[model samples]
Target: MREQIETADRRRLLSRLAGDYHVQTARRAATFMSRDIVTDMTILAITRANVRQITASPEPVAYTYEGVAGVPADGLRIPVSVYALAKDLGLPYENIRRRVKKLLDAGVCITVDGGVVIPGATVVRQSNLDLIAETQIATEKFVAEAGRFGVTAAQHYRPPTADLPKQIIRLAMNYFLDATTFTAKGMKVDVVAVLVLRAINMANISHVTHDPALAVTYAGMEEILPHEARQPTSVYSVGRFLHLPYETARRAVIRLEERGLVQRGPKGLFVSPDVVTRPDVLEGMLYLVALTEAYLKDLARVGIAYRPNPGSPG
Candidate 1:
């Protein structure tokens, strides 16, 4: 079958999808997830807009040699217009935006002129009438390392499985957001239904299709199980996953277990099968289900392994 390449209209739709969470509800999610949902929503919108505007087509152009010919990997520097940079690299604007967002969050790209400016970002010269080829490659590499995604999940990452967990994670990250407890939030939504979403995202980013929710659940399992060792994940597991202290991971895991979204299986605590399969009782859960589905699908596409079985890495 022919692949559905991203069209302008599709890009527009994706932009909308990225920022669709409702205002009040997003606020609550922000509180629960750590980063303000409103802020993230705005970032989502801006990212889409910037990406759409800049990512249309990439072309190399001669540089006037502004501050520096190339952007430094470290230190702070504001970026130029999203459109101009994307064009200069001969790459898609979507790719540019994804990379910029990762760089921004990781403290790699600093915003200036409402976009990004890197001192040694790329090596371009006036004589060539284009950006140096190596510069574009470097920028892409930097972004890929930072875990960027596109409107479509399958095209999000290429050669994604080069590193198992990281590749899998980079693929699925679009859904992960900067949140602390997507798993718990998922329970209020339908864990089982979202499986389709994860599958679609996996197909999109990696061009590899699989069951969405189960893919993510499996991915979560991979995260908890290290190097094929399945220890009963404790609240400590949550903290470890979030890069926090043992207590924090424990607290959140316990909270979900108490809520009955998850439970201790014969092997370890697991997301309750009932919770995974059942529809959300809470009326507000619909939106969470949709958005979270989009996010996890993005993850699945990128080879983030998800083992549905407790302590199993699929």
Candidate 2:
């Protein structure tokens, strides 16, 4: 079993890297990284692709891979001939397999019979072409966003390969869709949403005295906005989104402002500047957004009216 897997992996590398690599070069590329992180990334991709299945596939199980490591919500692998899909995309079939597998291991996609399929989950597939095009589009969207964090795909390579761009975009899509950010404008948040929030927060906290609770809220502001807009970062709008009270909203904003999180400005409130520029800070902010979303969801579940206010945190 191990030999079959290794041989298959090697063959994939040869086919994908054929244009630039000799036989020896192919071997070198295969050894570039261990399979652990690669495997984790694959799992992430499979989980995203099979969003519903990873969650619990509505459809009956076709074939089951027992004791499947990194099995997602569905708990069944949607087997796909990823090599074939790469060919359809006109991508380097060999070059992208490792990446595809990484996604698989990470739970982004599942191996189905004919091809690895992006299951119908949060993302709708109008056509196979739509799926491919959308995936490509998702990749580009993420690259532009990552650039702000100095994590451009180009930075990792000297002259950046074609596969690098595509792979980065794929990874970006994963980072993006993981959020549950819903906007008041009846739209969805994307990379620009994060950037705008980061920038807005940075613009807001320039003058506020720091407080703890407010800091927590503003830190996650990037993930909660209605998209890129020049609006205040007070949770009242978010409270409005969650149908909270003016006091609940007011308290949330004041708390964040006290913590140097909600910076008041000529434009409106938003996150502090330092939160946007620093990656570690930005990550913390992302974590905050996630945490806030979960908390708000709990409030909504039972139709509770827990509106926040502009009260100072005790």
Candidate 3:
């Protein structure tokens, strides 16, 4: 029998996977929350903590549509303190406190005896038919992509209920926290700063890969560009997308430049090939593969109907 990976390694792998997953998930959630990035992120931080608490249970978490007492039945009511959110997300206490208040005032979250949680009503509002449809499409695509790396045995599994989108977001959020923790130690920078860098890289990729056919030329591998090739991204754009302050984003970009992770391009700032190919970066990619395999197993455990996606490359 194959030996199981140690718990620490598994956590690291999942965190890395979740971090990459956040690049898309956060954007989606931000859109749903009316483009309030701080509020959205604060809510996610609490939800992620809640999911982690439940997932550590001795048995597989069962689905529930009815509330027990006053707590949300579907989403595990894991109470999270504001200070904990600040510590976990590497943001300042005052910022998290303010966002938490906004969420509370907006009915997006409720305070329980111990702490705050996203209520069932809020979740219901968030998980509309459009969001569900979008999630189904994205989940199918994700399963198909994971198959290329030999992690597809449970690809066809679908969650038994309509709450899969929420679950996916929860899992992604949990991974995001795990990722932020690991990265802060490894790169000695805030997670928000890392996000700025990722935003710039994604912008550059979008600029170059004009169409699927052009992307096909690289066969899904990282496309290398000559140093002379200009892939410029403005700090304002990155800040706007991430909901960060312009000065904060600019400082982060400056720090990355000093570390040789990004360089000024014809347009603005772009990720350096050196940074992309770094040993630590490559290892993170490996962790993503491991996380995908483990995530599939978790889905199967929860009884999602596993099947090949129609978009699978076959």
Candidate 4:
């Protein structure tokens, strides 16, 4: 018989699932924006603001995921200033201004009377559509994986009349920003450090999630897998994967190691079980769980059904 999914088990599963989804989606966004993950984050911040404006308007037009692409460039896009963006992202004003300038030069964003907006024309592009499609696929995969671990949507839920995909994307962006901000401030690390550590964590457990036996064996283990089960990853590999410069990745890893958040071994690098079990790190994991639960509930509200498995009490 399969084991029950306890709170700890669910937290682990959700963390892994959210980590993978964030990395994949961030990579795609970076590619689409022709910029680094940080810049991509800036763009997401702007887009999130615009999305909010559209959704909050009393206008009669419907805003489905596809329909959003057809909306007028200036219809409901509430321009967000650099100061506001900086505040929202917890980044410096100069940094946000520089990124916004680059985006303006690249035509990825346009300056409006008040501030800037990711234009509808940009959103209608094939590349943007492709990015949205990829996010949709990743979102589906996340839901499926969570279901495998017995985290399913409630049966009585119903889909909302509003734009479900757009709202979900906004929720995801919010989760990413909130999680990044929380981890950076709580752990006394930069965004790059957070990404590097997450990359290492994902690398360490990639195999366990791939193999059926290992997946089942570790599904309820709340702590990190045994050292023998981990697949260590090198700094160079992480740098290449995240499109970060070698020295930048190296420095971040070194800082993480010095902080006792990462471990170095003969093979490569991995997050230590001790680090995973730390009170602060565990709190961050629970924060991630809370955000994920809220996200799932939103999906459930929109009738994206996630049923519990046979004989499982969800």
Q: Which candidate model has the greater lDDT, 1 or 3?
A: 3
Put down candidate 2 lDDT per residue, 19-121, tens digits, no spaces: 1111111112123222232222233344444434442322222332333222232334355455644432333567458777665575445566655654433
Query: Quick one: ranking by TM-score, best first?
Result: 4, 3, 1, 2
- Where model 3 places Cα greater than 4 Å from the true spot, the runs are 1-21, 55-71, 74-76, 126-133, 148-163, 206-230, 243-248, 300-314
Give each model a TM-score. Answer: 0.31, 0.27, 0.71, 0.85
Candidate 1 C-alpha lDDT tens digits along 1-314: 01221221122222212322222123322333324222333333333333332322222112223444222222333335656544443335776566567657864335766565433332222311121232223323323321232223333322233223322212222233322124224444222112222222222222111223322333321122121232234444433333344554455455555556555656554433244334542222334334533553444344321223324332
Residue 277 lDDT in candidate 2 = 43
Q: Best-fitting candidate, measured by TM-score?
A: 4
Give per-residue CA lDDT, model 4, range 13-73, as digits (tens): 6677777766666666766666487788888888878767555442233543335733444
Q: How does candidate 3 score on lDDT? A: 0.58
lDDT of each: 0.33, 0.34, 0.58, 0.73
- List per-candidate RMSD values in Å: 15.6, 22.5, 6.1, 4.1
Tens digits of lDDT, candidate 3, 166-217: 4554454555555545554466676666677667766766534333343333
Better of 3 and 4 by TM-score: 4
- Predicted candidate 2: what Cα RMSD to the true structure? 22.5
Stretches of candidate 4 exceeding 4 Å from the true structure: 1-8, 56-61, 64-73, 159-165, 210-212, 220-223, 308-314
